[model samples]
Target: MTLTHNRKPDESKTAVLAVNVGKPQALPGQKREVMSGIVKHPVSGPVFLSFTGMTGDAQADLEHHGGPDKAVCVYDYSRYAALEELMNRKLDWGACGENLTVEGCREDEVRIGDVYELGEATVQVSQPRQPCFKLGARYDYKELPVYFQDSGHTGFYFRVLQEGEVAPSAVFRRISTDPASLTILDANRIMHQGKQDSMGMRTLLAIPTLSDSWKQTLLKRLTKLESEQQG
Candidate 1:
């Protein structure tokens, strides 16, 4: 499919509000230390981004997180208000392990293959972040991940297309959008909400820009469902 580019109005433009980076650290009550990177602070200057991830950022479990496909995690700052209401507390900027806290781009509006120009770096929306137990561990709220997933506010990840420096308040412009129009919200519903629309699953599987890990996961589910029907 041909990529479509549309320049949005200045009033509607999205920008980075904060750039956060973290290193591995040991947490209390956990047998193994987790590099959750959830306790990020805003950077005063530009930070380098790469295929693996931003400089100084590390993942505790590489098997399920951090790779060329899942390079940078982005969360919309707007969602925090709703989350705070849901959890009945104030949350910090990087409370969700996001590398970039952005404004204007929400999960439902951002497509799976949407490409954005973030400062000197170029990144593509890879897939909806799959919340895990670590989120609950970090926040001490065992149902936080479940609440995040149910809310459809599970922030998405970015695959670095062109490595460069990124900073806070940098303009984030969408350069292209995938024609399929399968958004991160839709994908999240299929994975978490148990929405079994076979045709939708096929469409998601056909998206070349989607993360292979997600594709494999959907394929396995689809295959199992088909097998059960045949039996």
Candidate 2:
């Protein structure tokens, strides 16, 4: 069950292009304040990442975002091209509200509990980011969240293992991976697409590396399903 990538990550292949952080701001045409750090600009020097998130980053909605497990939002640089094609427009690196715009690793390659040495900081993959309606609001496209979810290109989050500074062009080296084969992509599928598969849900629930928030949400869904059946 231990899956290993025998090859080391090539520094030239994997790198951080931008480190962006933002505070809460009022969305255009909306009265509510949203901490949609999606419009991040590149920082020239090292930025510190703590257990919660990048030093300057803040989340307005604590109900769903920004905790130890949901900290350090990461998006693949490769997916930008696909997203641009879908939206038929050019987008910036931090357009997805990611703290780090990363290259080389994609959702499929990153598994839950996979740890990486990112610059001076160490981070572990926590879960696939569930796109929210705020994304659509940011783009002014109401269907964007649905499109993002269905595209399966949803970026992932990281839990800071070792708080340290990270700069642009920093390389990420995979330190280790969980023995369970539940990848971020697989976890996303189980959460978003495989609702009818009770067996799959049970198996996902058993994985020790799965995020506690995700487990709780799945448990609620299962309970609701059971109640409905009994009703």
Candidate 3:
């Protein structure tokens, strides 16, 4: 997830290399299993993109995972090798629990509210994917989440605007330009890396395309920061 990259990400257009979906599997309570939907399997051909999620995909933690605002979870293809170098382990496409493993969709240049025509469906960038305990659970590395956040390789989510079929053969092309232009990298920086930057938090709050949960979080943080500054 580090800014250091083994490969430069192409931001012009995105190409789907694999489509993935997963159902929650019951895990042993003592095994650090959070009943996560992070274990995904790649699918071939076309899959229906709905307002909630893919056809077979089901999230164990619906409160944090699924909804209209997070219909699809996408991961940048460039992060795998970069992360592997840092972690010294091999990672697969679906390791990050993303529904779509895509190339040319790096977070540095990707902006919140940027609309794209992905295959037949229309989707807008909603927010950066936040790592939870499940990420460390799946990888058996308790500190992985910390490293992931620091690397700024956090993947992002897309809210589906129009329902349609998405396939591996389709290109995720940017259809509209965002005026607010808040990149996912900066969002992550403000939310996780630099919480004291009230100005950065305000910048993210101004973006109408930001996810509801993120907006509320920033608002609360900003209030707390202001109170602390006043105190």
Candidate 4:
């Protein structure tokens, strides 16, 4: 199934936001941050952002070095409908990446592998974040992961397609599905019921990117079960 949001373009009806760097040791700025890229959530809205300072060496270091996993980014959804709770908090405890500080969004509606168009940049959704220790360390909230999962607010990665400036009030459009509708929720169901051959289940495990622990187990069980049934 596919879903689309077609809205009339009006200042009062549309919202576009980008993640801007926060003030030194403070919350992020409340203006249009020049857009470099965006972070996606499986069941939530997108976080928009812009990068600052760092140059060639520093950029490489950031992506390939130790700080890559812990670097949190930010986006502003103050214009998007449904999200308005994430504004001005010292420590937003949900997705663990040191990426963006954000507010105003129901971040869970977007799923892993979905495609989004922001300004001129297009991004492919990757996966829901599995939180780590840095998040708790930054905010002293051990239950941050629990809350994020419970709230279904997660973000995925997007490969930069067309780089351009993105800011608050920018409207996002979903162009495609995640190739098989394989959600973590669906994986859990397949594991519990051992229903590997079901239509949706088959489609999910079909994706090579999704063939992890659960899919492996499911395939093994499926093979064994198939053999027994034939016998």
User: Which candidate has the top score in lDDT?
Assistant: 3
C-alpha local distance difference test of each model: 0.82, 0.80, 0.85, 0.39
Residues 16-128 of candidate 3 have per-residue lDDT tens digits of 87889999985444444368788998988799999898988999998999998888999998888766766677666686899998888888978999998988899999999
Candidate 1 backbone overlaps, count: 0
Candidate that scores best on TM-score: 3
**TM-scores of all predicted structures:** 0.90, 0.88, 0.91, 0.45
Worst 10 residues of 4 by lDDT: 50-59
Candidate 1 residues lying further than 4 Å off, grouped into runs, are 1-11, 29-35
Of 3 and 4, the candidate ranking higher by TM-score: 3
- Candidates sorted on lDDT, descending: 3, 1, 2, 4
User: What local lDDT does model 2 show for residue 200?
Assistant: 75
How well does candidate 2 score on lDDT at residue 22? 81
Give the local distance difference test score of model 4: 0.39
lDDT tens digits, residue span 58-154, model 4: 1222332223222323232322222222322322221233232233322334444555665545544433444443344334455655554554444
At residue 152, candidate 2 shows an lDDT of 74
Q: Model 3's lDDT to the true fold? A: 0.85
Question: What is candidate 3's CA lDDT for residue 44?
Answer: 83
